[model samples]
Target: MARGRKLDIEFCGFGDGWEADNKEKPESGPKETLPPPQHCLVMQREKRRGKPVTLAGEFFLSKEEEKALLGRVKKMLGCGGTLKEGWLEVQGDKAVALRHTLEAEGFRFKK
Candidate 1:
């Protein structure tokens, strides 16, 4: 062996004609069922110039469901909000009031 030299190696034991065989597979097995999804509303408040002026509301919902939910929250809070990247951005610090509204609408939420 030479110093700082590498040797070329080759593997030749495994069969080259290997193939997966599922001919005698069962007709069916136990079906895999996923757990029920959870619906949680998350609200956060961000401060600007030492004053809270923006509230971010995020709800886990499908794309179609998010539009309606965002509109409802914005109207209820009497504030401007937009849906972006699957999140609702309400312009103003309305975390406290928003939590109350969500709870009244049968939604479980967290800060």
Candidate 2:
């Protein structure tokens, strides 16, 4: 019943044994089928300093797919962009060009 610095503690528990399988593990997760790019949306915007930017949205895609697509588009256009809120926001007035690229990639350009 002494209220000194609370430094003493005791606990007991059981954990799963440390034995781990050494065999190569197969990948997990069912293959995710993303909707065709034609199901996506495209738009344009003016950001800070009146910078023109293009955005492609409405993608029924996983985060990995989105990142991969975004990187491919950015590299294809030789520009920069960030993936936000499941959308790809690219810098510059490249909406038209982006739309063409998307179309070539089997994406519909609906803006």
Candidate 3:
């Protein structure tokens, strides 16, 4: 529906937006080749139901990106985790390890 472009003839309303080819493409390569990251990650210790849980806070990402990042975090930590209210909660006090992992993923963080 953009620039009078026909939806039927275009790839629209999906992961990539309409007129995607017209947009500038992002540089693609190994992760380490990227710059100072696109995320500001924060980690903290929290409690729910009187049980300790580690919270990795406030990732500015869309739903799909958040889900993918959460999955990777969980898998890397080898522990159970969930996303809540735009926060990522991993089981136990995993703040230290979480910080390292996030940094490896090119995320910038502060204590």
lDDT of 2 by residue, 1-111 (tens): 567767553442334464557978775555355676537576756675777777777666777778788888898999998887656788998877788777777877554
| Candidate 2 ranges with C-alpha deviation above 4 Å | 1-33
Model 3 clashing-pair count: 0
Candidate 1 accuracy as TM-score: 0.52
Looking at model 1, which ten-residue stretch has the lowest summed lDDT?
A: 30-39
Which prediction has the highest lDDT against the true structure?
A: 3
What TM-score quantifies how close candidate 3 is to the native fold?
0.62
Query: What's the true lDDT of residue 81 in model 2?
Result: 88
Q: Ranking under TM-score, best-scoring first?
A: 2, 3, 1
lDDT tens readout by residue for model 1, 1-111: 888887744564336875568568773455332211344667767776676654444455555567777778888999887777545677777877777776776677553
- Ordered from best to worst lDDT, the candidate numbers read 3, 2, 1
Estimate the overall C-alpha local distance difference test score of candidate 1: 0.64
Candidate 1 regions with alpha-carbon error over 4 angstroms = 1-37, 48-57
> Going through the candidates in order, what is the number of backbone clashes in each?
0, 3, 0
Q: Which stretches of candidate 3 lie over 4 Å from their true place?
A: 1-36
